[model samples]
Target: MRIVVAPDSFGGTLSAREAAEAIAAGWRRAVPGDDVRIVPLADGGTGFAEVLHTALGGTVHTREVVGPLGDPVTGSWLEVDGTAYLECAAACGLHHVGRADRVPGAARSATSYGVGQLLADARSAGVRRIVVGLGGSATTDGGAGMLAALGLVPVDEDGLELPYGGAALATCARLDGDADLGGIEIVAASDVDNPLLGPHGAAAVFGPQKGADDAAVAELDAALGVFAGVLATFAGREVRDEAAAGAAGGLGAALLALGAGVVSGAGLVRELVGLDTELDAAAAGGGPAITGEGSFDWQSLRGKLITAVARGAADRGIPCVVLAGQVSVGRREAAAAGVDSAHGVADEFGLEASMADPAGTLAELAATVAPRWGR
Candidate 1:
């Protein structure tokens, strides 16, 4: 039997590529004669650029850029087929900030300026199109820092530039200067469809995840509202309420202001990896496609990488299985989402053991599940 193993990163424990490889190894171990194929995926977050580069055979360019907290950090982008793929997380992702440091001060000061620098770099390369993977960011500045980096400086009443951070945007009276992208086609690859401001907007929904308290969330939201107003005037249109405008902490709004289009991050990754075609081929051979992430919860059902993979398998009439770090999603919900079976490393092995050896425990779980599914 042929088994297709595809998984997103196991939280921060393993990368998508590593998770796929481990699953494939365990499946092969369970049944050496069975053929196993590995396909890794991302949803425009942590592993976005690496996963795309692996599938597209691109050149990865690395540069030193400002991180979320105004520190210098190494960042990279993928250039493939004259299209540059930029992952926003590489510049201002929450991963860059330590958990202990994720207090209100850090949350209020995070900036997306590094992402704009990357966009500038891509534009300098003369790429006709640029796809920005927008998620896992740490800022709620309404992309003010990004716009600032791109020459749309946010200024106070005194016409002085505002300091970096969402809180600083509260004092923003207007924007000085304009962004010049040279007319390059920009695409914002995102998973969430939240708008830029409101109850379901960036700060209200994602601020806490980046370490904002109740007060910080309120402050950031109000500040983002001010930033959005100024940006609407600058762009001659309103993008604050557009779908995905809240992604990457209002980076989506900034991109929209620059005439960027939005696309499903998971869908784009699946297409770039040819996951549907692979599922079609696997279906012909009668095999179950396995996909997973760190935690299989309610969030996984809402257009995440695993959901995209399961949908692809379902379309091809193939069974889809999941082997995740933990499984909090109910079986009924899993079935509704086109997942046939779900296994958890933490359930099989204790949480301590699973967290200690994510790859090994995941491989063990895959090996255990293989005989039942691989048969």
Candidate 2:
């Protein structure tokens, strides 16, 4: 029997690569004669660059850049066949700042300067194309900090450069376009589709999760409006309502201003990893494909990595089994979402224990569920 194991990162627990290895290891333990393939996946989030590097051979370049809170941090990007792959979370993710250290002031001052620094570095690498994975960002500066790092600084009424973070956007007068992207192609890969402004905008919806209070959310929204107005003047068109413009705290909006193509992260990753080809091969051999993430919920069914994997498996006439940390939906729901089988490690091991050692627990759960697959 041939089996494919593909999984996204389990939040704070295991990385996608680690999860795939653990699942493959356990599946083999249950059926030693069965062949298993490990394929890790990402949704243009924290592990985007790593998964792409693993799927396609690449040269990783590391650079020290500013963190979300203006601290020095090391970041990396991948170069594959003259194309650069960069993950925003590598520089501005919430993981860099501990929960205990995430004060309101820190949230208010966080910037995406490091992401901008990384883009510049990628451009300097002489890559013909750059794909930015916009997810897990910690700032809400509307990508102003990134622009600043790229030499496109925004100035206030007094002509002094504005401070870092979303708070400073309220006083932004105009953008200074001193930087040039040359002739490089820029693409933004993201899973979100929210516009840049209004009730469903970046600040109103994602601000609280990043530590903004009601007053702060309102302020950030207003500041983003001001920023949008200034940006519209330069873009020669209104971009405030464009889809995906709210992703990664408005980093997607910045990419739009640069005339970058916004694409679905799941779709891009699936093609890059050759998921469909693998699924077709597995189906021809009458094998099933296993996929999972931290949680299998409504969000998972809504065009996430697991959803794409399941669809690909279905198209190839292969059963898709899901092994998640927690399964919030029922068996019927899972089937309706194209998942043939669903199992939650938390259901068997309890939430605390499952989260404590997710890789090991996931391995154990895979073995328990192995009998139902690859007869």
Q: Please tell me which predicted candidate would have the highest lDDT against the true structure.
A: 1
Give per-candidate clash totals: 0, 0
For model 2, residues 1-375, the per-residue Cα lDDT tens digits are 778888888876889999999999888888887888888999888799999998898899999999999999999999999999999999998888788666666667789999999999998989999999987788888888998999989899888998889889999988886668889999999867778887888888778778888888888889999999877876787777887788888888878887889888888998999887778778877779999988888757655788888888888888999999999988888898789988899998999989788889999998888877855
Candidate 1 lDDT over 1-375, as tens digits, reads 767888988877899999999898888899787778898999988899999988889888889889999999888899998899999999998888988988888889999999989988898999999999988898888888888888989999999999999999999999898788898999999867889988889988889988999999999999999988887887799999998899889989988988899998999999999887778778887879999998899868766788888888898888999999999999999999999999999999999999898889888898999988886
Between which residue pairs do clashes occur in model 1? Answer: none
**Residue 247 lDDT (model 2):** 84
State, as a TM-score between 0 and 1, how close model 1 is to the true structure: 0.96
Q: Cα RMSD for candidate 1?
A: 1.5
Query: Candidate 2, TM-score vs. the true structure?
Result: 0.93
TM-score of each: 0.96, 0.93
lDDT of 1 at 256: 90
Off by over 4 Å in 1: none
